[model samples]
Target: LAPQPKAPPSPPAPQALELPPNASPVLSSGPSPPPAPKASQPPPSGPSPPTAPKAAPPPPPPSKSGGPLPPPPALPGSSKTRPPPLMKSGNKTDTDEDSSEAKTKLKPFFWDKVATNANKSMVWDHLKAGSFQLSEDAIETLFGCNADKKSGDAKKDIASKEAAQVVRILDPKKAQNLAISLKALSVSAEEVSCAVKEGNELPSDLIQTLIRWVPSTDEELRLRLYTGELSQLGPAEQFLKAIFDIPYIYERLDALLFMAGLPEETSNVKQSFATLEMACEELKNSRLFLKLLEAVLKTGNRMNVGTFRGGAQAFKLDTLLKLSDVKGTDGKITLLHFVVQEMIHSEGVRSARAAKEQTGSVSSVDNNDLIEEEYKQLGLQAVSSLGDELQNVRNAAILDADQLAMSVASVVHRLGKTKEFLNTSMKSLDEDSGFHRKLVHFVEQSQTDVTFLLEEEKKIRSLVKSTVDYFHGRTGKDEGLRLFVVVRDFLAMLDKVCNEVKEASKVTPKKTKTEFPHTQVFSRSPA
Candidate 1:
């Protein structure tokens, strides 16, 4: 072949491609590796087609300073796309394309945006400002999340969150207890209505339970608004809704409390009246008690012989207690001890005389030891039994006049509220409505009963005042019970003195007999 187209010299090995020091792997489209040198082969029959010149590598992107750009950051993981290079211009850096790409990638996880506090705050703001409807789950979550966080605008927060109804939701145990208690009551609206109208008493416990379950304002409003099937509601809600069917449910509940408490309250008033009456009778009519007073009066008069207080007609019952405080010439023996000894001797003499009369003969020996022994035994028994005779006075001493009055006033005030309710709340009902008619009739009857109670209370109080004046000669501003308290205290002191005298008689019988003078005779009435 034309001198054999001498074997064409192997094409000079392609020069190794060069890259910038900081350059990353070139993109696939940037350039292709020079075709591998053809396997060593005999020269081609014809000259190899003129070699094409390699395309110059595309110019590197320009930088602000017109220098070679640094390599773009390696993409995260195996991502094939690279973010746009950041461009610095003055103090501001522009990454608009990078930001756009990021936003596009984040769209798939849009809900994750709410995990941030800033985003959550925005959601709360919108929830409060707008009428955004929330599912029960959302409401529960909202309430649970902020339940412990105290906000300055607490009422507004509660209103926005509808927190009033969430109380039961948050405490399922309490809600369950309430439901159980309501079911246990098993009271029907009809029963309540009939009970109120007919003046029949429901169980006080039931009324009290109902009181505890009284709906809050929001809960009441909700119950009033709900018109759905009762079967769909919880037991507590159903009960509340059923009761709401009655007009003026709250006022009716108040009436129920008043009615339930009526018998006990009235009985208490009557019991107080009886107590005052018995106390007055005991104080006025007990003969032994009067005799003790006379002995005390005599002792006081003898002591006050030279003073203006000498020989007074009668002394205050309060002075009887002070007798123990006045010691005799012998400090060991108190004035009360002397009075007790004197009373014992007088009681013994009366017993002996009564025995003499009963047997129709006087004993020949006036100082017989057996008679003296019988006298001492009778005197101790009679004096110690004084507490039993004045039992009602002891009971009266504990009575609080103000409390008794308040009990009556409470009944009146409750009745007044019931009447007010009938005028205002029940006024809208038809006159023929059984509930309205029954409640009105019941209130009228209660008014009459309470009127009688009021009269009785006044009569009993007047009797108490009169009795106080009868004993004290003047009725002071203090409660009548004060007089009973004084008597009760004096009786306590007298009991103690009698015990000491009996112990002394046991220790030194002869000495005690001599100390007790037989001159004084205690009659059944005060001198």
Candidate 2:
């Protein structure tokens, strides 16, 4: 009965309200929107209102007017510069620190950092700063220290020996080939590294060899080993530590080696410079020899005047070979004999004139007869004088021009190498240090010297070519042989003629046969 009474009062049953076509559902005041569908129900199929993607939770409300919130305070013990986290390849979460660390690990080796002898000087400086311990095996391996020796500075002696070896290795002048020695050192270092990695001790002899070859001090060697940058060098750090344990020992040894290397290099540079200068002087002071060439050219022009190929501005030096082809009616005599004869005759005229002046007396003797006697006496002497004047020319022309040029080039090359050595080696020294300043000065001076030498070499080369061309020497074909060989053969022929003249002068002249008066008169009347 109570339910019936409540049902009578029950409100009209709720019904769905339809919106007019022109009325918006929002504007239409309809029963409150049907209770939102339960979460488990699907959304209605009819076109639903478009929804935006959920925005990132609105940034925390600004804490101040018109300004964004400040960053949250760091937690206790948190660093502002956090260490980078480890990352896998292709990881998107990697931080800059991680990227930088990866790049560092992937960096390639720079052999130039340690390969140069200059770096060894830097190593010495580091060693002087402190003492470090060396393992027993290292001492035996590098310094050849006897394992049984537990007393009496035996280690010191071994270190001294090793130091000596290092000096010899670093000084290029001591090595037959500097490049080869350096290469061998690099290979040995690699071998030592491999042996160490294999857990086998490097051969003592090999270690000794390396120690001898390596310019770096034992301390630097140890430090490099510790860093593993020299990983391939096997227990190098240990060996270095053992050898340089004594305080100030490596310092002294480094100084000694540096001083030792200096003298040899200095001497080599000086000697090379001296050689170049001497060669340059010889070329510059060869004026007399050049005049001799001019004289020869003049003589040749006069002999060939008015003929084809005559009055030549230049003569092929090879023409000297032809001088012997022209002989007198006497088959034994050649043009060289005539040339010598003329030279002797000229010398006699001068000699007789000088004698007359000295005597202040005019002898009743015919000057012509006196000149002939003088010619006989001066023949050998004139030949000797000619030889003396020709000696310089012969020396200049006979030298192996190619060899001399090559020697000059070699000196220049060596000088360049020495300059590079000084520049690189002195870099480790303080700019204000005496050695550094000295090296810089030497290098500068050497540069000037080298420039001057190069200029002189150019001049010499030009002179030699001009001389060859002036001689009317052989042209295109056999030109090289013509320059020297022709002149050399000519000088040889001249000497032979002088010898012949000397022998003739030693002999008595044969008397001429006299014709009877009738026979002589009849011979003259006919022709």
Candidate 3:
């Protein structure tokens, strides 16, 4: 068999650190990436004598891509001084290639020693595992006032205790420094809780700072922790628990949920108001319905001409409901039936003539067709139609405007109450301070958002009351539900009657050319 080349010598074994069992590196044994540029510089390349490969450390498991992991990175401040280049036979040309090879051979040993030292320093454990404990000096700096005092239960006692204990423990400047260090070390929430418990009361500044620094203490976690009444807590945890205890916190939460629905509520009101305005405008201004009403009034007058009810000056809108109650002598059809028949016949006469005059041909006019053409001209077709527009109005009208207004007003009131409580109880949150400034900005913005549609709402409010009064109804603090029902039923009945008239007209026969000779005369005379 052909001779096989011996396997290349292994890379050097890395030096290991001596650590307590519990304090060993928490970082993964797999190789890490290169250290930052500022920590280490790459070595210069040159040639030197060839050297055997240094021994390699235990190989990392094959990566997902089927290669071994790279070596762990050198730590910051762990780089070694580069030695002078090696020479071979005192010739520059011969030494150039060999120098590069020798440099590669020696590099692993130096890096192994540097990495071992870095692991011994335990900085990696602190940064990677977030296991850094508060030093004695840091603890002393935070709570080092050498005195103890007792607090009383009465008003004076509470004041004295808060003044002595809470104030001294929460020095703003020291707390800020501590927060900076904790952030740098990537301290865990448990560590933060422990640190806070060591100090009795949390300063408003600290609370504000920590909220930004530690976003992990989310609303859900805060609620879960605060809701548990039997759990033992540190002073910091207790302070956090107390902050949540503020009644306004619950109020604020409820307000947020309510605010979520405000957009849809506001949209419904605006759209409903627009629809009602359109429908009412058509009812007030359309001439077709007016003419129809006049015909009905004439019928009523003729019916009661010899009676005491004859020649009425004006009739209430409620009179429309009584038309069905007034039956003919046959008792099979009511006054409403006669009225609808008259309206449909009128539509046929007027529309057939107009069609002959416009088209100059009686053959083009179908007297049996519904008065849809006249309806279009009088704008009554759109008024009688009910779809999303009617629904929009109903949705708006059914809303408890007073309740919505009260809910919004309540939130505004609570904001003011919270501001007062904060000012009176925590006097430490100075008006000019960052926390106070941010808080004021928030309140102002909230008030603006809550009251954005107030003016439009006021106009709609008055309009709604007027609508009720117009219908001879009243809705005292009921958000117009009764008023809306009346309007809804009235419009629905009108639509049904209009539909009936149209359907009845469809079965009526067409006016033939022989029946109307006026169209032939007009067509011949026209230029």
Tens digit of per-residue lDDT, candidate 3, span 1-527: 99755555444433542343455344555555443333122332333323432322333344666454454544445676555455667665746778755532221223343344643756554575555675655554444433112212366786676555542222345445544644555544554344332322233344444544332335326544554442344333444344443333332332333334445555655555565555544444545555556656777777788999988655545576677687878886667766654554454455446657787665644445534445233333433443234554445445565675675566556656656655664355233433334445555665665565466556666776675555454534433545555445545665666676566546865443343222111111101
Give Cα-based local distance difference scores for all models.
0.70, 0.47, 0.49
Question: Can you give the lDDT of residue 217 in candidate 3?
Answer: 34
lDDT of 2 by residue, 43-114 (tens): 334444323222112123343355433444343345786445556788587689987565423224367543
Question: Any runs in candidate 3 off by more than 4 Å, and if so which?
Answer: 1-255, 258-276, 352-442, 449-452, 464-484, 497-527
Model 1: CA > 4 A from native: 1-201, 226-238, 308-311, 329-331, 362-370, 420-424, 431-441, 502-512, 515-527
- The per-candidate count of clashes, in order, stands at 0, 11, 15
Clashes of 1: 0
Weakest ten-residue segment in model 2 by summed lDDT: 518-527
Mind giving the per-residue lDDT tens digits that candidate 1 earns over 374-403?
777777777788889999999999898889
Runs of candidate 2 with Cα error greater than 4 angstroms are: 1-314, 328-330, 361-367, 421-438, 465-485, 510-527
Clashing pairs in 1: none
lDDT at 173 for candidate 2?
A: 35
- Please report, as a residue range, the 10-residue window in candidate 3 with the lowest summed lDDT: 518-527
Name the best candidate (by TM-score): 1
